[model samples]
Target: MSIFEYAPAPESRDIVDIKPSYGLFVNGEWTDGKGEAFKTINPATEETLAEVACATDADVDAAVAAARAAYDKVWGPMPGRERAKYLYRIARIIQERGRELAVLESLDNGKPIRESRDVDIPLVAAHFFYYAGWADKLGYAGLGPNPRPLGVAGQVIPWNFPLLMLAWKIAPALACGNTVVLKPAETTPLTALLFAEICRQADLPPGVVNILTGAGETGAALVNHPDVNKVAFTGSTEVGRRIAESVAGTRKKLTLELGGKAANIVFDDAAIDQAVEGVVNGIFFNQGHVCCAGSRLLLQESVAEDFLARLRRRMGTLRVGDPLDKNTDVGAINSAEQLERIRALSEIGEAEGGERYTAPCELPERGFWFAPTIFTGVSQSHRIAREEIFGPVLSVLTFRTPEEAVAKANNTPYGLSAGVWTEKGSRILWMADRLRAGVVWANTFNKFDPTSPFGGYKESGYGREGGRHGLEAYLDV
Candidate 1:
């Protein structure tokens, strides 16, 4: 029976309270961790969900050694068909436990339950299902006769989409016959640990995958470990650069999916209502914690006033509440630290002579929350317009012509994604050709499919995370 079918009944609570501690998964079993310990908070309520083991340098060494052994002994020579079966099993398990996973994700990560349930969990399973099909088909992937695994992979995921990112890393790595030592962000370790249980339930081989939890130090130890043959990182551009510098001259293969400051361009001829909805969804999804959020809004001079008026009215209708609430649209900020970062940046925007407008909404006193903020009259030179403000913050700028729109959109060092809203198909193609972003959405925003290759260009980072392109990241050239 599916776990969702038998999911525990919801109980009334003044506040949601989760357990106190969790163990690390090593050698396919949950075990006591070596380093100091830390606590993960419910960002919505500031309640401690659990204490997580802060992985030490020694712990990273042990995890790496185990992964190396698993590669040589179990996963390395495992036939592609066999690996595919295991991935299929994982997909099944995730679906069976989908609701539980979604609830846990919302509780730990502060994203709305609707997003965790409808988007993250489903796509995570789809990723595994898609990659599973590629396992035995490697011979047909155009990679010349024989392709082999990259050995032990060291993966580090960010806090923004913890479990989904975990799926992205582990699914492709395993499908390609590589063992992994994955370090989940310290604040969002719950779902990853739960995934460890799913692996055990599927009877995956020992050390085929391991989950380690900690802050930056643990991730650094894992990435820099000598035994790891490949390193995959998804986080900030600043940290991505550090990883690139750290691995310089080393033989370790690296693939990074970093930060973005995406542009959502609204033309004068757009379907106004639909465009407004897309704009809201693009920037406010996951509280704008997404790496590819449409943080910069480029409004055509002809429709600037009308678009902003509709956008502000639409923002007012959004429901903000507990992440676990099934009906919630916007949830709490992920952490106190991130909330402070957003506040600081917003203040910088105001001090730099940009106008700030916030939607009028009541916020919970105890939780870390930031009202959805929009800054107009923003110059491209303003810090708010240039930086990747990974929060529910948008900066609006006016463009007199299509040329001006393209110039303003391409002005950033980051080139992750952009949105083009117009009824004319020709304009979309033209704008898409001109915009220097990884993904271009014509009439929509934030649409994803496992078959679609997704990644960024320039300092937003390199390497795709989905489809056949993702396979290249795990293969030895």
Candidate 2:
């Protein structure tokens, strides 16, 4: 370690004033839920940030009713340009209050302030801005000339990128003239609540957007609600399956962005230094909490040893500590439960004969933290390679040929995302064509844009969530 000591550069927490308790946002008002309130804490310090009300079946019903009312009266009858104005206002406000939202997100979600500031918040605002322009041009979106709104879209987002996921689900729905009842993940609901305040600040019509804060039950209630015409979810594969089952035989249109075990494949012809960086970013970004994180690394046998050495050195430099620290590279795990799951899966990896290595960073004492970890000598059948650990863990497996790489990468049930690193353009295109994933990143990893259509091919879930395709989920042809 270098001798030069850097002073702590912490983001000011004073920027956000958290309420003692928060209520559900329904019909453009803050209302109490039928269920008991639960405390939301910072996973970095294990400090309780606020008591957020858990929505019950009754609350879900009320939200759906509010959304239905808004769809029938305010939102549905509103002209396209009028709807565009409201969404543009929202996008602008998010930018104006970007700092506060970023700080709050880092606090509640235990992701580094840098990530929340640089990645999540910017993308959240951009998604809205991107979709806002589409509000008045639905005819050109290619679904039909006179596409119509599906009343009352029910959206359930995951904790990994709470506000960003919210923007993905809500923006398109609103742009297409549909009202929404959204449920933010239980662990990270603050930014969504703050967004509710943004809606109020924009003077959005009453009942156009309803925000419910709760756990799996609340999500289920929203998904199963009779008045909800379209349901969108971003979370676990298990929960997605359950939601799919619950909505069966109903008229509700469904779109799910669920779990993934993506493989980042590196061929012998790849630029070794760039491939190393891509591997690091693939599994370590957002503490590996990303649903589409490239958890498995497939290296050609000729380059595996050299790549592993460089990757180990890279992982050692990652700093894991307070999320508010601007210099922190990796932050705490999102929850205690998630940390334990990571630990259990790592133990399974070792038991299955894979060699384990972790970063040298020291964790803070009070919160949920998991070091950047890698499992070498991993087989395709290893649990760590197959399962979505959803943490800062990577499993390394080698392939002798391009065909072997493709076969190993596609062996899993997930088809959410994958990465390819190579200098050969023809081989890159060939691999991309053969891969079963929805989003294939050539020469990069984990890059997201609002204009890109993203989702999966198989068990990763169905339907696209961005670009022109996103509008189709909320519109009737």
Candidate 3:
């Protein structure tokens, strides 16, 4: 053990006052759900955070009916500038209460405070800000002279980045003059509920945004609701597939942002030091719970040994512990079930003869935790390399040439995102051209901007979110 140990510097939990219980936000008020309530716990300490109401089928219907009514009576008839003002107010309120939201998000979602504060919350505000400006500019967006809003958008967001995903789904829908009935993930509903409060603070019209909290059943109810004219989802590929099938043959406009096993390719001629950082960010950022996380690393064989040595050294310096700590790097796994899934896949990797290397960090004993892990001898056939682990695990494979790198990178069924690190601009452009991913990072990895449109191709799901393209999802083009 090292003699110089850093003391814990935890952020004050008093910054956020979590309520004992939360209710569904429907038609501008908190109301009891038709189903039993569920408890959400902090995955970092296994501490119960709050009890949240779970929406039942009737609750979903009521929420949808509210949204449809708002769309037809208030939101739909309102001028675009008025709608823009509400969105701008919401964005400003998000910025004002950012610290509270960030801390609450870390507690509820078990992500590092660094991420919740700097990345998630800020981006949440930015998404609203970005789309807020577009509220009145739909005509010049190249869609048509007059692009009309679709009625009542039903949005289902996953738990990985709860508030951010909600912003991604809700911002564009509202900007296009559509009302929203959003169902947040069961495990991470607090932030969305808090966002409901933000909606209230903005004086957003009643029923413009309704938040439903529940498991998959509630999401199904919202998605299949007859009054909903649009559906947007961000979650596992399996769920996305099911949603696609369920909404098939219907006239509902749909956009699904699904799973990814993205590739971060490093060439021998690249800046190895910068590339190493990019690789770490690609796989381990957010505890590798990102939908477009670069879980697969493709390295040129010539520099594999050197790169691995540097990567291992850097991984050793990561701090894994309480999410509220200001200095913590990696945080707890989102839940026990997710941790078990990660462990099972990692065991499969070891059994298949892949060499496993985990970051040397002490995890808290109380809650769900998994160390940062990497499989060096991974092959294309290995289950860890093929499936979406959705945890802090990386599967490394080597390639001899650029062609082979692209081949291995594009081999997977997912094509949500990809990254390439090289000094040669021509090679970067060449690689980007051939890669089928929706977002390709040339030198950086996992950098997101609200101005950039994000989504996937192939089995990774279809349609785009963010930028002007996001408007098309909720508008009659």
Superposed on all Cα atoms, the candidates' RMSDs to the truth, in angstroms, are 4.5, 1.0, 1.1
lDDT of 3: 0.93
**lDDT per residue (tens digit) for residues 1-477 in model 1:** 111222223323333335578878888877778888899988999988889888888888888888999999989999999999999999999999888888888888999888998999999999999999999998687765787898999999999999889989899899999999999988899999999889999999999999999889999999899889999999999999999999989999999999999999999999999999998999899999999999999999999999999898888777777787776778999999999999999999999999988987778889899888899989999999999989999999999889999999999999999999988899999999999999999889999998888899999899998888888899985
List, residue by residue over 1-89, the lDDT tens digit for candidate 3: 34247798888899899999999999999999889999999999899999999999999988888998999999999998999999999
Model 1 residue runs over 4 Å out of place are 1-19
TM-score per prediction, in order, is 0.96, 0.99, 0.99
Superior candidate under TM-score, 1 versus 2 = 2
The better-scoring model by lDDT among 1 and 2 is 2
Per-prediction backbone clash count = 1, 0, 0
lDDT of 1: 0.90
Task: Pick out the ten consecutive residues of candidate 2 with the lowest summed lDDT.
Answer: 1-10
lDDT (0 to 1) per candidate? 0.90, 0.93, 0.93
- Deviation in angstroms for 202 in model 2? 0.6
